[model samples]
Target: GIFFLLLFIFLFQILYWSLKYFDINNDASLFIEDLEFQDKLSEAIDLHEIKKSQEPAFFNPNFISDYKGYALGLSNEEIDRLHQYRKAKKWIYSAHEFQKITLVSDSLLMKLSPLFKFPEWANKQKVIGAKTKQQQFSEKKNLNDINLATETELQRVYGIGEKLSNRIIRFRTRLGGFVSNQQLFHVYGLEDNVVKNLLAQYEVKGTTKISLIDINTASSKVIREFIYFDREAANGILRYRDSAGIIKSWSELEKIENFPLDKIEIIKLYLSL
Candidate 1:
């Protein structure tokens, strides 16, 4: 009986030690799992911090520094283009204008545009919108006639001084009043931006009464009198008129080898078939 009791005690001790070891193993596995979860969480937090550090700050699109542009993922050429635009004292009022100036890719523009912070006036100028070419805004009320705008009024525009204003008036008088708004471009020293500003305030609202030159009968010298027509274009028109017999349609002039059909619309202002 004693031997049996001792055997039972030994069996009970073995079972208790085995259960204790098993419980310790289970607890160790749980601790390992917890430590692994903590490591993963720390890695995630570090990754988030790195990403936050890499994010670019908001900036004015007009005044993008080289480093800021690089951080924004803009190419060297695109940054140079922006610099050249601002060098001319031009302003970028919208993301569209910024893209148009820099020629940045649509995807990059989409990503960077949201971070642009423009001035209050620039934000208000958004109502004018932007275009790929020149920005053409509608004429406001009480705007003066460009054809009759006085030297004083012309001087009111930003780029035009006393000399430029007088020159503009002289050119208009020589042309017997401006036939088209584009004629302003013909005036020497009138920069495109200045012309855009001028046109925004004034326009060719009145028609100047003048006899249109008959293209079929007018001499080359007479044709050359118009600012758009040069000696070559004038001679080409005469040659076409001679060879084609009668210039029925203006399109026939397109076949005149070297004739400039590009200026047809403006030339039509002074000539007729």
Candidate 2:
């Protein structure tokens, strides 16, 4: 009886160990499957992120924030430059102006410009309702020559106060009369929307004769006196002039390092070769 009892105990012990081994193997199998599933989920998430980035979405560049800029692949410096421009209360009217301010690469601009959604006024769309009665009357009377516009008359436009009107008039006079409507962009303290409103009513008549400065012969001081040009531009012109001996064509100035090419067209109105 003792031998039989001992044999029964040994068999029971063996059976318990076999069941425990099977349970452990089953748990290991489940853990391996779980790890595989986790890896696949991680890969799917990564792919989704990459695809989202590749797809372009329309956005207004003027309103870009640091986080948005980073997602759009803009450098920190480029983002900061855009923010600085906005902080000055200036608006970017076009993709070209955005590129000019941010100084982004041409390839990046091409990729991103298609996604830029500018304001309707930026497209030169006339918002009739936005104009004042005085502006509308002036347009109808054919007395919309900006060169002849008085401070009082200019103040009639929306958002054009006494200070802004005075600034515009002073700048116009300093420029010896605007040769082109494009010169309006050069006026200091002029808001982009205000300029648009003013343009809708008035045109640069070009009736006034302008005394353009001789580019080759003008002194740096004289060049700096022009509102469109600064000390840096004045120095660049002199350097280019010295190197080329004489600036025969306006296009040659484009080769000058750090030259403001965007302002060249308007700048040419006040300069002669």
Candidate 3:
């Protein structure tokens, strides 16, 4: 009886340790699966096809963070780090260095490897180094030579798309040629990633004429030039202005339903009266 009791206690001890160490509660597995799904879903969201109606869906960081956490078994700190990494280029070590990154796991690092490629190009170029082959090619393709180049010519640039090219041309017609690439970011529908990619490849020549687009007088086509305001949002802004009268101040934009804070902030820079 004494021997049997001792044997049972030994088995229980082993089970307890296994459960504790291995996280037998199943939370880890669930979290890892959730992160995988989030990654797949994110990839599936075609940034090109995304409309103003879809902006709300895309902007919800909480939803994205929560889903990612479940998929990757990430702690709050790990989730925050992931978002920071996405928003800006940051230090991302290898899977072996996961222990060094607080709250990050080796498995999570492996999963995120696809999104976190090292900036090899960034390293090669010094701050004052001569232009790279890509940069030279980009500079040679100037937007000012409209007689030679069409909308397709602009699209050849790393981040320039059909929508972006159209916006650029429209802005050029309104205010003249792009004096700076920073002005491209002011155009509606252009993503920050696109702007960053453009800045990496090309340097804008000359000074930008900082024209404040009058929200009251600006056409739908003109208003939609801002990247955040899709066709629907532009129409909504017009409709509200027509019905209620011109937006006297930026604060009046808050009255418009579904006008996201981030979008408002972006629009504020370009809007006047």
C-alpha TM-score for every candidate: 0.46, 0.51, 0.32
Q: Which one is best on TM-score?
A: 2
> Cα-based RMSD of the predictions, in order?
23.8, 15.7, 21.2
lDDT of each: 0.77, 0.81, 0.59
Q: Write the per-residue lDDT of candidate 3 for residues 1-273, one digit (tens) a residue.
A: 999999999999999999897775676776565778888788667554565445432222212354756565677776776555544523333343333544566676556544443232322223224568786677556534332235787788787888887876776666444544445566668776775565554545554555778888988788777655667777778889889896887667766755654434445656689
Runs with alpha carbons beyond 4 Å of true place in candidate 1: 1-138
Which of 1 and 2 is the better model by lDDT? 2
Write candidate 1's Cα lDDT for 1-273 as tens digits: 999999999999999999999999999888665778899999999999999998877777876778978988999999999989876757787898899999999999999888887754454345535442333433545567887788999999999999999999988875567777767776889987898789778888766675678888887777777655677877777777778788887556556755654344455666677
Task: Estimate the overall C-alpha local distance difference test score of candidate 1.
Answer: 0.77
Error of model 2, residue 150, in angstroms = 1.5
Tens digits of lDDT, candidate 2, 123-172: 54234455799976677575488999999999999989999999989998
Clash-forming residue pairs, model 1: none
Q: Estimate the TM-score for candidate 3.
A: 0.32
Winner by lDDT between candidate 3 and candidate 2: 2
The candidate maximizing lDDT is: 2
